[model samples]
Target: MTSVTSLPASEQEGARTSPEDPEKLEDPEKATLSTDPSETSLPNNKRVEQPTKINWLLTCVGLYLGALLYGLDTTVAATVQASVYEELGNLQKLPWVGIGFPLGSVAVILLIGKLYDTFEIKWLIIGSVTLFEAGSALCGAAPTSNALIVGRVIAGMGGAGMYIGALNYISIFTTSMQRPIYNALIGLCWGTGAILGPVVGGAFSDSSAKWRWAFYINLPLAAVVSPLYFLNFPRYNPQPEHTALEKFKQIDWLGAFLNASTFVLFILILSFQGPIWRWAAPGSIVLWVLFGLSLISYGLQQTFSILTSPERRLFPIDFLARRTLLLMFFATSSAAAATSVTLYYVPLFFQFTKGDNALEACVRLLPFIVPFVFFVMFSGGLLPVVERYAPWYFPAGVLMIVGGALMYKVSPNTYTAAIYGFEILIAIGTGLVFQTGYAVVAAKVPAHRVAASIGFINIAQIGSICITLAIAGSIFGNLGFVKLEHVLTGYGFTDSELRSALAGSFSPVFQHGDARARKLAIEAVVSTMGTSFALVFVAGAVTLVSAFCMRWEKLGLQTTAGG
Candidate 1:
């Protein structure tokens, strides 16, 4: 027991004050008091207050639920896109549902991360969850593709906040020894969500009574979790208060704007090519120029902010200066890119090559779902017991490369078991990297900046997803579909029938085609997918680069200068 009055002001405020703050009660001639309580006995009645024990089980459950919602929104839309397009009457705009969510998410994540740093996380959680639910409702009721895209954008903002906020809270509540397990649980949430989203979406779409129920599903879950989040999550208020104007000044709104502009330009270039515009179209050139300029502007802004006001900038120079942080950023980005490409193409293969409907395709992809769930939970449980996490990255990277290579060999006649095996490899690889990367970032950065750092990492992940998906879509549209359709017309299929078949995905082509035409279409499909799989190899190379960036020893127990 130690009495408050006996301790100096410095010691009294040790946990609260920044290290850079002046020692207000220092006496120049006196020696500093020892932090050890054994030096002086305290009054029997006085005792130090220990921190409250967090409801770990509930927090984990809540985070899992939040992550599940995010995965559901992202993946479920892909399977249901044809169904939605049938009702919405805009086949050309179908890609918007996928592109909009990640685009909106990447734009706000950096700013929201800074907000998490400067304000209480309680408000962020509350606001984001509320907005997400509202967006869900809007999406469920959407009458057109445009309205659904808008709702998804709103939902994306909320999802970004939840992702950053949950990771931040998990870091706050857990000790170093406990952090790996918690991080792993976050990965588990993602894997579970990925597994559930397609199944749920496909089932609802197949029922046809209410395809909109997929969006409505999030409402009840959110209602149950909101109150628990409010009650159990700790509050994080900033010590130095600033006005709304000052707070706005702190955020790099220009950076956010540039980021969004870059993504939109890239997506437009990818999705519109050959569909609405030629490859060498003036619009494509204009978008490419805009993207390049936006990127340059963003880089300059970040550099200038660091140089001019290193101390006050939202992304402090210290966080970026660390090699580990840089490595983790690249690692997470590559890993995200890899996962998105795999998820994007798997269903495409099923739809085109195997001639399966969305519901049947989802069921066929269970190999992916089963492995992801098992490996994620297993990894989460094992992280606490393991002494070193760095070695795990190698296996993860290898599995990813292997999976991508297997996918490169996929043909219309290839056995379903082979595809399942490849998917399993992908699932394991993704599980290995997802949580491990977060753990490394958290471990390397200071406690106070954990939320902000994790926020940046989340941005990198979503940003990579947006960029990769756009790239994949571009490749698929340009190389696969356009050529296949031309080849089909040469085989004497009528314009209307060919248009109808291509409009609904490649499945309908197999149903109506002669044996020779079907063979050629399958070969073209395989060649197209092989090109996409080549992109995964690039992702694997990026993973190796990420591995080179991690410095395990350097990351241990270091504080940022401002702390």
Candidate 2:
């Protein structure tokens, strides 16, 4: 019963010239979209240029490579964690190595989207690739952990921009009829990168020197893709005539600062709350309060722009007003959180409960990862037949909920078959929902500004992943530590030993002299990780609620006055 994620805008407007195969694209140059003719400002005769099939195919390959790099970077860094810890010897600061990249990407993600709308997509793609290469080179050559962390941040900033730029090209290079297949391609690259990150990262973890290759590998990929993008992508910039100063003035710095600062505050609090300071501590409380205030200020800023002058807003008020867009943002956010949680903590479950090594645990996740990759591709293929995303949203979300509930029900003795079944269910659900909302958003946004619209949805998706990780992480740490401490104390383990175990993620208890203590420790770890699955359930429920709220029809572009 899944619905099509995006139909030809032409179909919605009764302007579709052909109900062609979804695999086929209309002549990009000859295709006139559903928008007002006055809105098109292209010079005479320029509008009729058709993109040959070969150009479109190359463009898809280029965009897929771009997506793969980002996903690959994310997991590869994690796979090298232990080597990084040993090399740096500053275990306390290690969180920054991972957190820095996402923060840097988040800081500029929305801003980067706006850049695409205001500037040429080609230059932005080129700039993003340059940043990625520079960062990778820095990391490969880093002499200290601090240097590596900084390199990750720089790389992330570029990755975010590149990701947005890639999506923008997908929309432009392909007609609506052709978009779903390519959307599936993007999803495949992203999902494969995620799953492959661990596999590839594991390859280097066997030796300390090999860790550098984790960063170095991205270099060749970036080299191949960037030039291909510039040369192959059409010279199709809307080419705004606004002055440099004028374009700069259009940025909503106040909103940007608020958004970045608020997220930073949240990340810091989550990172240290239970381990370094209790949640109710004055520092945590102050940060939480400031976060609330920052959000309020951001809301007010957008509202003021909407009423006074819409063109100046950092957050587009009118666009946010659309009911479908709003639901998609939060719904996808929940779904993203669910996928992140399942991919991450589920593996932890395998390692803790089954005593699998990191590599083994990750490899065993094939049941989940394989279905995820295929089903996402399946969802795209099915879109042409269904013509709507809403109906599919419910079943996908329900599977997520069911999958999560099954995982939550697992005990220390849960059978291997049951675990595999649960993982498969979750992966299938993730496949169905992963790109559904974004496809809807891309379809609904004005063709001219698709980059920003897609960017905003991506922000929600990535932000949800991080935020859910933080919340689930905090709860897992607090609860696991509490249980592990009690169990270890009963086994006569010293307080210093307990503190050390907490810092080391409580894996030592499984290696203790007493078999009884080790058993108790495993149970404690499983219980704590189970609580995190509850967050997945909550996220699934959120998506389920949001699915019904999304409009089934073509949405307005939600334009502001200046737009």
Candidate 3:
């Protein structure tokens, strides 16, 4: 690496390498030798001095809190469904509870990505944290199902910012060589929070505070870590000369609107089609048409938008069109779908098949969670030393395929021991690739385009979770209802009764049913759940295609002086 002090002031403050460089760079772990203030700048240019070890540690804590919250919110509602259904009886809108968060995230995430590059990162972080905390409070205090869903959407929007911010912080503050370690650590926190979400939700639901405290718990932790963000974060302003209003004007509003509407319409179609309305119904047809139109408009607008330059577009449209990055996006989407569907259904499986309460059902997931947490760190650690990102996906894909196949065969008759064992394979598989894609994107893009590249990959990650969960929910709810109706024919259950039973095991109809009726209901649920796992099987298969398509190359890091 060149010494910053030897360069002229202008060069020292704005040194950068283009994305076309063939050789990958790595960190030497050297201390900054220059005392010049110009050495410190934005990630696209120069890096600043390192904070004291204690100060960096505090900053990391603040950053990891965002990651934790992002992961926690992903599945906290999984185990709380029954408790929520009991308190708020609109079981018809149940999928919205899970869909709301990811919807909010996918809608605004692209804009948030562009904002990080255009404005000072510190204020954005503060604003995002404030939104997340406020949303958490609203969720805890919500009086109805609709209110709860609205709160979740707000939290998801904030979470989209925080998720990108976590990666953004690591990108700016650390050396490329050190990034693998730090990125792996963030993955550790995120995976831990993800698996623990259901456990915490279950615990809260079983206690006197009920499901509401599941959200309330975030407030105290956010309060504790927020000061670190304010005090320790490095300032980054890419365009200091531009006013805030000018920066805001650079956003591609048309592209953003089209992107958001496209996603919203697609999810609506999935949520309603074949469940609430027939596929040929006018309502479904209208949603499908709007979704297609929105998608077409987004593409056209992105390609020829007069409102914003290519640099200011919400998505890194041309950049991600590159072969390697495109493969990464597909692989990432599959991995995300596999993980989200598994996490959402595992607890529900135990609850339905074993007659377990929310707490017991969630606790039963340790088999999957334990290995998942371990291997996520393992993959992150291994990637840096080996410097090979592609091969890791092989084992991940194989394990997920095998696990998904085994899980798909799981009936109500399957042994509990076997079910527990089957989960480990999928857990190990998913944990291997969950966050590694971010590191790869950072390595692949130009220094200035790292934020946009990472955000684009995240679009796949968050979008898959939203789309797959909506599809999976539709499958589970509708299929299970049909099967239950067939079995309980002449038992005199209404459509609402069947739908309520699908939402939670605590429905009064289930209690009123005879032993024969209960037995048939369990069969219906297990079979429907087994069908849902087929999506996991397909995800694993698609992941293998990505793994084989990836380039077998070492991922080298590039960093400025302090970095």
Which regions of candidate 2 are displaced past 4 Å? Answer: 1-52, 141-144, 207-209, 306-309, 490-513, 552-563
lDDT of 1: 0.67
Error of 1 at 87 (Å): 1.5
Over 297-340, each residue of candidate 1 has an lDDT whose tens digit, in order, gives: 76776678732354345444455656666766776777777777
Ranked by TM-score, the better of candidates 2 and 3 is 3
Judged by whole-model lDDT over C-alpha atoms, candidate 3 comes out at 0.79
The estimated TM-scores of all candidates read 0.84, 0.85, 0.92
Give per-candidate clash totals: 0, 3, 1
Q: Cα deviation of 505 in candidate 2 (Å)?
A: 8.2
Q: Give the lDDT of residue 309 in candidate 3.
A: 79
Kindly list the per-residue Cα lDDT of model 3 for residues 222-242, writing each as its tens digit.
988887887776566666778
- For candidate 1, the per-residue lDDT at 293 reads 91
lDDT of all predictions: 0.67, 0.68, 0.79
- Model 3 regions more than 4 Å off: 1-16, 19-50, 557-563
